[model samples]
Target chain A: MSLDKHAMAELIANDIPRGAYVNLGIGQPTLVADHLPADSGVVLHTENGMLNMGPAATGDQIDPDLMNAGKIPVTELPGSSYFHHADSFAMMRGGHLDVCVLGAFQVSAAGDLANWHTGEPEAIPAVGGAMDLAIGAKSVFVMMTLFAKDGSAKLVEKCSYPLTGVGCVDRVYTDHATFLITPDGVVVRETFGISFDELAARVPVKLLAPAR
Target chain B: MSATICDSAAEAVAGIEDGSTILVGGFGMAGMPVELVDALIEQGAKDLTVVSNNAGNGDTGLAALLAKGRVRKMVCSFPRQSDSWVFDGLYRAGKIELDLVPQGNLAERMRAAGAGIGAFFCPTGAGTSLAEGKEVREIDGRTYVLEYPIRGDVALIGAHVSDRMGNLVYRKTARNFGPVMATAAKLVIAQVSEVVDTGRLDPEAIVTPSIYVDRVVAV
Candidate 1:
C-alpha cells in the first residue's frame, strides 16, 4: 500500500537526527514539523526571520503576525528568536542549517533538484527560499510523490523544470518508497508495498539494492 | 525631541514624484501601510517602481495601485499568490515589469543597500537560471553569485505603536520588512495605530528608531 501524506511525514520524521537545525520548505515538507518526536531537539527555522518555531497554531492560539514563510500561523518555542531578514538568510546561505526538507516537482538521478517554478509563462514566479536551502543545507531531503497524478515518474534522467539546485538532493521520501541518491546511483533504501522487482520495473531509472 | 507626525497621509507621501521607486513593507496585508498606499493611489503618481515581498493581494492596497496602472515595475520574491490577480493580469499583458528575486536575496539586497554595501556574493542562486548573466565566483571551493543592493526613494511602512519621538514597535509578524525598508529608503513614512508622547515608550521595545523615520501618520 502506498503511504498517505501523514504516513510519509512520519517516515521522514523518523530519520531526522536529534539536535538538527532544519528548515521545512513550503508545502508537504512543512508537515514534517508536526510529526517530529517531542524530544527530537530539532530547532525549526523559518526564512521569514523566526528560529525555534513550534507547530502550527490553532484557534485562539493563532497570532496573525506570527507566521511561517508559507504564511501559516505558527507558535514560537521558549528560546525562539527573531532577526532581520538579511541575518536570517545569512544563517541559511552560510551552511548553518543541518537539514532542510523540501517539496520537489522533479529530482534527477544525479540528485539535481527542481522545485521552484514550472517555467510556465502565465504562472507567477514564486521562488521563496528553495534555492538557498537546496544549496546551503548540509543535507537535503525531498518529500514528494514518486509519480505525478498523470502517472509520469518524477525521478528523471534530467530535470525538465528549472532547477532549484544542481546535484544537491541526498534523499527522497515518496509515498511508494524511500530512495537515496549516492555517487553510485539511485539506491532503494526501502519500499512500502511493491516488490523490489515491481518497483524497479515501474521506475524509469536503474535502482540499486540497499547496501549490506 | 518630537516626532515628525504628518497631518495627513498625503502630506506624509508628499514629494513622491513619478518614476520614483518606493519600498513597501509587509508580508501580505499584515503589516502593510494601507493608508500610505491609499495616499499614493490618491496622489496618482505614474510610472512608479515598487519593491516588496509579494506583488499585492486582492483589489486593495498595492493591488489597487497596480490596477490603477500607477506601477511600472515590481521587484519582489513571490509575485503569484492566489489573490495577486492585479499583478497577474498586468504581467500577462506585458504592461508591467517583474524582477523575481529569491525571498532571502530580496531581503539581503535591501539590507545591503541600507548597510552601505555595494555588492555581495551569495550562494543562493549561484547555479540556477536566476544566476544567469550575473557574476559567479568560487570562494573556498563554493560557488557564489554576485548581487547588488536595492534602495528606494521612499518607504511606506506599518507599525503597531510609535512614540512622538518616532520610536516604533511592530506587532508580531507584521514587522516583516518595516525595519529594513525604513533604513534602505531616503524618506520613510510609517502608518501607526497610535502615537504616544515622546518619552512614553520604553526604549527597549523600539524596533525602528527615529533616525530612520522621517514622518508618521496615525491610521
Candidate 2:
C-alpha cells in the first residue's frame, strides 16, 4: 500500500542511525520526531536555539521564552542546552550535526534542493535555516509529497524554483517511495504501492535499481 | 565602565536617530523586548532598517512599529509567518523593503560585526539565488560565498535578569540573539525582568558580559 505521512515518518525514524544528532525541518519533516524510538539515543536540534528539545509543551509545561524554530512553545529534556543563534548555526555548519530532515518543494536528480522560495512574485519568501541545514548535515533527507496538486512530479531533472542548496540532499522520502539521490543517479531504494515501471513513468527522470 | 541603569524603557531608548540600522533581538515573540520596541515607537524614530529573526508576530512589538510606518526596510531571515499580516500588508503595498538572509547567516554576520571580523566565506548560501552576484571561492575542495559583517547602530534586546553592571542572563531559548546582538552594536539597551546588585549575578553564569552592554532597564 502507498504510505501516508505517518508511514513515511515512521520509515525515516527507523532508518536514523543510533546516537544521531538530528534537526527536523519545519512542517512535515517534524513528524519524524514522533516516530523515533525512546531509547534510540537520538538528539533533536531546533535552529531557534535549543538542543534536546522535547515535544510540544502543554498546560503548565509551556514557557513563553522556550520555543522551537517554528516558534511553538516546547519542553526541554534533561541535558538540554540553550545557545545563541551564531553557536546554534555553528553546530550545523561545523559538521557537528549527523542528520537533518528537510521538506523540499523540489529535489533534482543531482540532489539540488529548492524548498525555500517558489520564486512567485506574489509569495513572500522566507528562507529560515534551510540553506545552512542543507549543506551542514552529513546527510540531508527530504520529505515531501511526490507530486504537486496539479499532478506533476516533485522530483525532476533540474529544479525550476529558487534553490536552497546545491547537490545537498542524500535521500528523499515521499509518500509513494523512498529514493536515494546518488552521484550515479536517482536510485529507487523501495517503492510503497506502485511498481518500479509505474514509478519511473510518473517521474520524468530516469531511475536506477538499488545497487545491492 | 559599567552600564547606566535606566528607570524606564523609554529612557533607555532615548537619542536613537532616524534611519538607524537597529538590531532587535528575538525569534518570533519569545525574546522580543516589547517594552523597548514600544518605547522606540513612542520615541518616534523613523526610516529605520531593522535586523531580526522574524519581522514580527501578530500586531505587537515589531509589527506595531512597522505598522506606524517608521521602518523603511527589514533585514531578517524569516518575515512571512502565519501571524505576519502587518508586514505582509506593508510589503505588498511597497511600503517596506526586505533583505532576506538565511537564519544562520543572519546570526553569524552580526557575530562577525561583534568579534571584529571583516568578511568570511560561508557555505550556507553557495549556489543559490542569494549567492548570485556575490564573490565565490573554492577552499579545500568546497565552494564558499563571501559574506560581510552586519553591524548595528543600536541594539534593543530582552533578557530574564541583569546585574547592576549589565551582566545579563536569559531564560531558555530567549537568549537567541541577545548575546550576539549585544556585541554587534554601538549602544546596547537591554530590558530585563529584574536587575540585582552587581555582585549578585554569578560571573561564571553570565551569558552576555557587561562590557558589551551600555544600558539596562528593568521591565
Candidate 3:
C-alpha cells in the first residue's frame, strides 16, 4: 500500500501516547490532531494559550472567541484549563510537556528544523514559539513532505532554510518515509528501509535524511 | 494647577503606579509600544499587571518590564512563544504572576469591556478544565461557558500616527490590541512615532478615535 501525506500523518498521530502534552506546529502538522485515537488522553497545547484541545468545530458551535495561533476556531476536550499566557509557556519551557509535534520546511541530517522563517528579508521574520516548543518538549516530531516544491529532497544533509532550533528534532514523519535520528545516524526503521547507498540512489541532490 | 509638560519617555510613564493594570499593543514586536515600555522600566515601577498578545522578544516590548522585575502579573495568550529572556528569568525567580487566556478570548474580553459588555456566554471552555469553576449555561440545548470582561487601568499603545485630537492609526501587527484596549481602559496613553493634524488622518485608517484617548505622547 502506498501511503499518502494524510496516511503518514495518521500513522504518526497513532504513535503518540496517552496523556501527552503536545504542541502542533502550524501548516500540515495541524492535521495530526484529527487522526489521534479518541481513546488516547492527549492534551494539545497551542503556544497561543490552550491545553487539552479538541478537533475543529463544525457549525455555529464554533466560538469566534476560541482559536489557535492561526486564529482558527477550535473545540476543547474534557479537563481543559485556561491560564495566564506566561504559565502556558512555563509548561513548555519547564519541560513539563511529553511530546511536541511540529511541521518542518526542511530537516537536516543532524535533525535541525527550519519551519518558521524563510530567511527572506521581505518575509515576516517572526519566529513565534517554534523555537521554544522544539527545544522545550521532551520529544520533537516533525511532519513534512519528503520532497521540496521543485522535487528536491527536503530531507537534506543540511537545512538551507534558517534554523528555528538546532539539533532538537527527534523523529521526522514525512509523506514518503518515517526516519529516526540517533547518535549513529538516520535509521530507517520503518516504511522506507533502504541502505545508505540505496537511499542516496532514490533521489537526486545531496541526501539530508539521517544516514544509516 | 500648573500643567507639567513631560517630554521624556520616563517622565511620561511616571504617571503609572504600582499594582496598576496596563494594556500593551502589538501582535509581536512589529508595532510594540517600545517607548512606553522603556519609560516604564526606567521609572522602576513594580507589581504591575500587563495585558498583551505576547511579550516582545526579551529586552524589548513587554519583556522589558518582565526583565526589570517591574511586572507582577501578565495576562496574555502566548507569553512563552517569544522565548523571551524575562519569561524564564522572572518566572523562575517567582517574581511574576501569569494567567493564560485563549488568544481570541483575550481579545474578545478586551473588546467586551470596551463595548460595555459585562459578561458573555461562549462555548470555548465546555468540557475542558477551562470550564472548572465558571458558570455553565445551556442555551438551545448546547452548553456555553461564561467569560468575564478584561479591562485595564491604563492602556499603553503604539501608533504609526496620531492627531492632536488623539485619533490613532496603527501599522501591521501593532494594530492587534491597540484599538480594543483603547476603549477598555480608564486612561489611555498613546506613544506615536509621528503626530499629525486633526481631520488629516484618513477616516478609514483611524483605529481608535480621540474620544477614547486620554493623552498623547510623541515618542
Candidate 3 residues B99-185, lDDT tens each?
766555676678789889999876443533335788989989756678899999988877778887888876533355677788889
Top of the candidates by TM-score: 2
DockQ winner between candidates 1 and 2? 2
Candidate 3 matches the true fold with a TM-score of: 0.55
Please write out the lDDT profile of model 3 over residues A1-212, one tens digit for every residue.
43676887798789998878888877777888888888877888876556787777779757644566555677777776544344455577568888888888888777787876577644423445666576668899988777778878877787888776667788988765678877777766455444556656754434444445
lDDT scores in order:
0.89, 0.95, 0.72
**Which whole-number lDDT from 0 to 100 does residue A196 have in model 3?**
51
Candidate 1 CAPRI assessment class: medium
- Kindly list the per-residue Cα lDDT of model 1 for residues A101-148, writing each as its tens digit: 999999999999999999987687888778878988899999999999
* lDDT, candidate 2, A1-212, per-residue tens: 88999999999999999999999999998899999999998999999889999999999998999999888889989989999999999999999999999999899999999999999999998999999999999999999999999999999999999999999999999989899998899999999888999999999999998878
Candidate 2 lDDT over residue span B1-219, tens digit each: 899999999899999999999999999988999999999999999999999999999998999999999999999989999999999999999999999999999999999999999999999999999999999999999999999999999999999999999999999999999999999999999999999998998888999999999999998
> DockQ score of candidate 2?
0.92
Q: Which model scores highest in DockQ?
A: 2
Candidate 1: residue pairs that collide: A65-B173
